[model samples]
Target: MRENKSAVLNRFFSRNTFRDIIDSTDDEIYKSVILRYVKNPENKKNVELISEIYTELKKNYRNEYYYKNTLLNKLLLGVHSINTTVALTEIPISKSKADFVLINGKAIAYEIKTELDNLDRLENQINDYYKAFDHVSVITCKENLALLENKLEIINKPIGIYVLQNNGSLSIIQKPLKYSDSLDKNIIFKILRKSEYESIIMQVYGELPQVTQFKYYSECLNLFLKVDLDKVYELFIAQLKKRTKVEKELYQNVPYELKFLTYFMDLKEADYSRLNSFLYNQFGGM
Candidate 1:
């Protein structure tokens, strides 16, 4: 008489964005929900338990948000490691930004195409990502997978494809061929800040241009464009990875869904504190 499973799922999906989930850490409201689906995933959910929840999600939601959050959960719970840095979301590149990006040994950009999204910008998105990332993949539902694959081939691109499986796990259908050509230096440095670019120039190339303050950005861009891309990207990844350092407690215990929000979204200190309050109580932390 308490409630039904679908009712619970409906409420859960409504708690979609970061603000909805962490309004108050005192209630431990998100506590059980996270532990069941994500925390200590293997030790927490058996085959029967996993199947029940996965089935409900597929039946109830067939959009980009559901698919991406599920894939994020699986990746964070399954693929993440202490040595490897768990990373960014909606990251800007050139004219476009990737839906999510993970950094460890190499940069991998994931573009999400739900049944609800259009393919008009897929090609353009992949172009921006390939220049900056070592590997780029599109994660789509089955309905869009074939169409996306055909479009990728029509354009003669080597982007990979991963189909979100019915059971809420991601399977790599096509491996993204590693891009080996020299990247556009302007596009690469454009993703960095003034300080970041200045730091890289000083460290790797020995010095920055002592140009007029008005021309500093242009001169720096030109100098960065002239530097060897391999070395530039090495410096870029190092700089990007350094940003993932969070409060040690938060780093160890933040929810997979909230980790991006807690670390990279640049929330005000009050909101960050709200999210941090749950750190000491997480199931598989550290």
Candidate 2:
């Protein structure tokens, strides 16, 4: 397939594609990818075909989504309990968007450099992430491991490194140590939404900013800057954990391949039911 065609196939792991599937809405990209990838679509259910396609992608593509899904499966679900952890994606920090963020007791930022990705912006991206997150790590493929290790070592930062092994396991190359030297209150404030920051202010000071709507943001930011940075981080994690809470029982039923998408989809109970049905249905049956 051409690059353009492969681009269409990549949508299989996207949230919009799963949303369409759950809603039973016909998606051109889904149909096209399925038809092209599945050898005999007559007997295979949607879920089976998706798993097969994902397996192939892991071997060849190894795109950002593949890294994220593997992390969510192995680290989030396998290593930590979903009930105790919260995973966020594409979180903007300073000038870069963090690929994956896991908030357990403390937050860790993961910057994924897939085999297809270049190291051009990695240093700056890691710097930006440290403004808000204390622990930072780089997750890459085996090919990029040594280069990343050497680069990070030269920088002499406490950043950790992990390689997504071909056998589908995360190998810890270096464990990240907590480095709070770079934590900036202003940058942390920038990551929060108005409501989240407002909640933080209320919890800490027992009231919102005492200013007009025009000055509300500035007043809140000024107050946030005055609060202890460590307290702010604790509040930050508490606030973010509340952002995406799913029913544990229902989420446990979500397939491993779709865990990343499902976590960020904000799917309701009805949507899960529809998705469950769609996953088990054959192309003809659907």
All models: lDDT? Answer: 0.66, 0.87
Best by TM-score: 2
lDDT of 1 by residue, 1-286 (tens): 2245434444443334346535643223233444545545434422233344445467655554466566556665467764565667778888899888778787778999976579999888888887778788899978787788889998676788988866666888988777847366777788887788889989967988888999999988887877778898899877777665545443545555444345555455565566555343333311
Best by lDDT: 2
With candidate 1 superimposed using the best TM-score fit, by how many Å does residue 124's alpha carbon deviate from the native? 1.4
lDDT for model 2, please: 0.87
Taking the tens digit of each residue's C-alpha lDDT, what string does model 2 give over 154-193?
7677998999999889999889999988888998888899
Which segments of candidate 1 are over 4 A away from where they belong? 1-58, 251-260, 263-286
Clashing residue pairs in candidate 2 are none
